[model samples]
Target: MERGTRSVVRDRDVCRRHGVVGVLVEPRSQARCAVVVLGGAEGGLHEADAVALAQEGFAALALAYFGSPGVPSSLVDIPLEYVFRALDLLSARGYASGSIGLLGGSRGGELALLVGSHDERVGSVVSVVGSGVVTAGIDYAAGRLDRILATSGAAWTVAGRRLPHLPYVVPPELVRSIERDEPVSLRDAFAALPTGDELEAISIPVERVRGGVLMVSAGDDGSWDCVGLSEVAAGRLRAADHPYPWAHVVLEGVGHTIAGPPGGPVAPYGPGPGVTFRYGGDPVLTADARAETWRRTVGFLRYTLPRETADEA
Candidate 1:
């Protein structure tokens, strides 16, 4: 199957566990069935992006773990176990065999790593601005609060909008729970989350995983320390002596989100300090970078995905 627009299932219940729902999207062709899980923090799938993947010959499934009000969309809210449940559901549906691959960004990136680490079914993964383990050094929650306060106080502009102060604080109750380790602390859970250790601890048959990974990062992802997360993940991969084919690319002058070059169609930024160059909502790259990265990602997938090898260009 080649690139073509076709209908695929969307927003359908794939599975449920612990009051969380796993939504699925099924691609048209059975020749290759691959699911791309979205980051809970980013909400739902962009209809355009979903369609694009289907056209590219993938059974792209955007699993929604959060985004529902009060359900906890932040990395802290959802447990790594939820991602595993989504993977399991797809496996039961016969989505793919040998190993499953997952894609995630921001907080979702962390979740993807968690799933790929513990679940043997995960074939490969692409984590955009994600971390291998959640540790106390990051202080993500506090960092988020600090950034919000700083942005509020700074003089910034975006698309003519004045800098905005984002005064947000985690609910006190949630904070209390985290401190008490009631149930399980998010940081503790994340640090303890299985995946980044030696392959023995990781369920995926890494050597068999063809594409391995594509880790991408930006200069200023929305998070307080996106760079730290990226670095930590990269370090883990190296420490583990990962043998699978993998590449890590950190784009300069870009934020957590992908954006086009600064002068051309500048990506929309929120009104806040550093907002002018903070996050990106558009694709950014020189023709060469764009072409090369695209080629690499496609080639990597083609080499890794079992179906792609059988269908050789």
Candidate 2:
């Protein structure tokens, strides 16, 4: 698609030579910056969002860490190195390490913050409805259902070692509901987790991030306590006196799924069949929040990772 003088181009084979599963989108003209886009527990390449960013004159890569042919089958113990490979690919495309940003939503949001904290190359981050601490992964296989029903395993790893994580405490009723394939809200399970000094050990250590951070959450998130988690990250940044700009935004009356890009269908929240999840927010309000969140995200990225001027380009 044409965007003023620059036309958008997509390269599905952009990272294939490096054994990375992703699609790269950018303007035919030199891009201003680069961003790595990640999806949540739904697990897939977020190509649409990447294309949207590309239309705005940035090089965007929609990476798939799981639920793809070449990656892990599920969300368990995904290696951070996999993401680094994507960064390396972007770097090879002439984007400086300092010009790269990470954007993610829900579980992907948590992954983005965690990655930014570990990698100095990341210049900016936008985490939507993500967590401030490491949390257990989800395994859907019937044989491993017991493990998932309890604490399960860590969602991420580095150098083949699992990171410390908080475990979910599922109640008996919720377990029964899951067994019966009934619609269930996992919010109660998350609320049942202990809130104490123990959490400090598993915290994301946001102070280590080398660039600006923007944490976005919904006030009425039914999937988990996103607002509280975002606060935890923001508080850490403030306490460290982070040199880069940082802000936390809370969209009231919206739920866990509040990061949709603009110009898309704003469908009402309605769970379809067995084991459906509820996000908790008015349909109209959630639609509004999605649009607002996208605007804020774009503005934040522009501030933190500004595009090159005409002379530089």
Candidate 3:
């Protein structure tokens, strides 16, 4: 939905009231459900994700965890309580139901699983191109110890302490390729994340989740092995015998950034057609999958967190 659409309401700075930095999007009328939208390592609030659900009649708050004014400098030293605060605030909002849902992509997607599994306040989770285990961010390691010329390191920190994370070091050759403006395959840089027995240590405990789960992934995710990781999460849920309805939607030919553009196709950063933006999937295929993924996400939320009132406009 475009800005100034009569059916919608947008508050560019809802975080001020909540003591967080983010955006709030809602329908003009009362909403049947409430959802918290999250963005990944790229930082800032995910305003578009919130607006997308708002257009579908849910009250969505895109809470900023990092990369915004007054937000954390990096993923380090963040607080899970901030997420809980958002959840509690939504619970108190009369326009929405008592329970809350989470929708996130990439790093946001990884966090969606964490909050959904750990916090009973969350009733459902929608993760796109997210991992089953905690993936590290760039600054997580470099910030602590200097002289480590690594590309990807620990990405998350809570209450000033960093979580145990796996690093993806960019090879020296790839670094040179980047300096020379040559195309270096991202696969060469993405580290081989933990697997099999190692997964037991880092994986999120989905069995503890009190609500339904839905995850989306792509086979050719150049960013990381999301499809493989999603399977790990699905397996965890099954092993735990999670009673809630859950599904891992693996879209073929899509990339790590599976969602559709907020308004239009994202512009290439800077002058040349750079390698950094080399997310897989053709425009048509990704768009079709994006629309369908969101359609099912809304459906999953509706089923899991049905409205206490019957006022869907």
The root-mean-square deviation over C-alpha atoms between each candidate and the true structure, in angstroms, is 12.0, 3.1, 4.2
Per-model CA lDDT versus the true structure: 0.48, 0.81, 0.71
TM-score between model 1 and native:
0.61
Give the Å error, residue 2, model 1.
21
Candidate 1 vs candidate 3, TM-score winner: 3
Candidate 1 off by > 4 Å: 1-7, 15-22, 45-48, 73-75, 135-211, 220-225, 259-268, 271-277, 280-298, 308-313
lDDT of 3 by residue, 1-84 (tens): 234465778776555777777777889887777889988767887777777788888888988888889887677546667887
lDDT of 1 by residue, 279-306 (tens): 4423454323434433454555555666
Per-residue lDDT value at 274 in model 1: 19
- The candidate 2 region of ten consecutive residues with least summed lDDT is 265-274
The number of the candidate with the highest TM-score is 2
**Candidates arranged by lDDT, highest first:** 2, 3, 1
Ordered from best to worst TM-score, the candidate numbers read 2, 3, 1
Give the clash total for candidate 1. 13
Q: Would you give me the overall lDDT of model 2?
A: 0.81
Residue pairs in collision within model 2: none
